[model samples]
Target: MTPLRQRMLEDMSIRNLATNTQMSYVQQVAAYAKYFRRPPQELGPEDIRTYQLYLLETRKLAPSSIGLATGALRFLYKVTLKQPWAVEEIPMPKRPFKLPVILSREEVMHFLEAVSSLKHRTLLTAIYAAGLRVSEATHLKITDIDSQRMMLRVDQGKGQKDRYVMLSPRLLDTLRLYWKAARPTLWLFPGDLPDQPITRDAVGQACQKAHRASGIAKPITPHSLRHAFATHLLEAGTNVRTIQLLLGHRSLATTSRYLKVASSTVCATTSPFDLLPKVEEPPPLTPTPPAHF
Candidate 1:
């Protein structure tokens, strides 16, 4: 039983899955085992299907939850247990695609202005300025900033892959001011405890507070900043492929979604009203008709 869990962890690590993903997969698999009061290895495809049904019908879990369970089971059987046929027949539920929320440049400025703490403000600014996920922002180090090259290095980003993103001049000045005030020794945004980096929860709470203060009313989060970054860049005439590289996205399709969010795209299109031209009535139509008659 121990070996089964170990094997699953090994498979996850081998794939270089994101840390959050690794944790979620492990937890989901463990939950399945706990639900049956038996090791996951003892379960076959039928059991997997039943568990999925239980999650949906009995637990009334969200689609995302069900999807995670399906993914965990699939990985367990296919990768760890070496019984691909057992889980191959199980079908994953379809998830609805939704566009990310994006804040306009002015709204983002207002949100940033509302942040009281320098550390929190700078961290949030860096997130938008560099198009970083909150996790990446919180884990940033002084060494990661390449001032000369104007690039921010993201280590072990979303996919456990390292990548570089642009660093704006305004963001650089803000960081310099923040550094002078905080004098951080290790992590760029260190938590209250010296040993660890600032928690993602801290960044989230800051965003919530700022959102309330800004009165934007759009259900914004730190991620919305990243989305806004992409949308604004696209509006600024940046290429989608270039945005994809900057956002660390694996596919151009993922980056293409920003085209819809871009203000330029929305503004550049012809309006419905423009399609119908107003017609002027002929002033002398009656007189001309009478003359013709």
Candidate 2:
């Protein structure tokens, strides 16, 4: 790696950014440099603006993608190069507000059952059972399973925070069966290399195949299971603050979004009209005299 890249990596490490975040930042910066065919340090605000336009007009990247690229460029200039220009010059694109697609309990069951691979099925099941992100699920170790406490410890989840989520009795049974069959030594789901955990892409591929086999019309990704988990809990009457803690969301607003998608929660809610007093029907109006016309 070049000296500049090494320094940027060190800066990210010092701030304790998540591994996935660091990787994304590095990749985005590299892509930005390649686009201009010049070092990022030499580029200025005008180049960044042009590059943002290129991402929007030419590459047609999603707002989230452009935002990530912009963040990387901002870090490269402000943190790495120590540029005097204000970081706000690198404006992030506005991401559209789209509600997450939630699957009903039956749909979730059908999707999980369609997964053919035992390991993949177990991993996906655990994610739905505990409301875990793909990265957190993939990085799970054998010791993380606390059967006695009926909880699973999520280490270094998003934002580099550790937390515990409930372990359903049914899920524990499924995991026990998987453990006996696979006998994972270190990682709960070890990859082909043994030392490393299973890749998120592998889980994603499994979800894709399962979605096809299940014949579900709605999209089914690993994150979809997590969405279903949160919505289902909300429908079951779990409080937003509690769910926020369970999901490791820094903001309660993030967890409350599930309320919009929770069908039962939305439907079961009492409407304002229902609370209004009942009124008898009024008499039919008589025709008004028009003799003056």
Give the number of the best model, judged by TM-score: 2
Give the CA lDDT, 0 to 100, for residue 243 in model 1: 92
Residue-level lDDT of model 1, residues 1-293, one tens digit each, is 48777777888888878778888989998999999999887888788889999999999998888999898888888888888585557788988888787888899999999999899999999989989999999999999989999989999887678999999999999999999998998899999897689998999999899889989978889999999999999999999999999999988999998887777997898898888988777677454444553
> Can you tell me which runs of candidate 2 are displaced by over 4 Å?
269-293
**Model 2, CA-based lDDT:** 0.93
Which 10-residue window in model 2 sums to the lowest lDDT?
Answer: 84-93
Per-residue CA lDDT of model 2 for 49-137, tens digit only, reads 99999999999989999999988888888988988783868887888999988899999999999999999999999999999999999
Error of 1 at 124 (Å): 0.6
List runs of model 1 lying over 4 Å from the truth: 279-293
RMSD of each: 6.3, 5.4
Model 2 lDDT, residue 196, Cα: 99
Q: For model 1, how big is the CA root-mean-square deviation?
A: 6.3
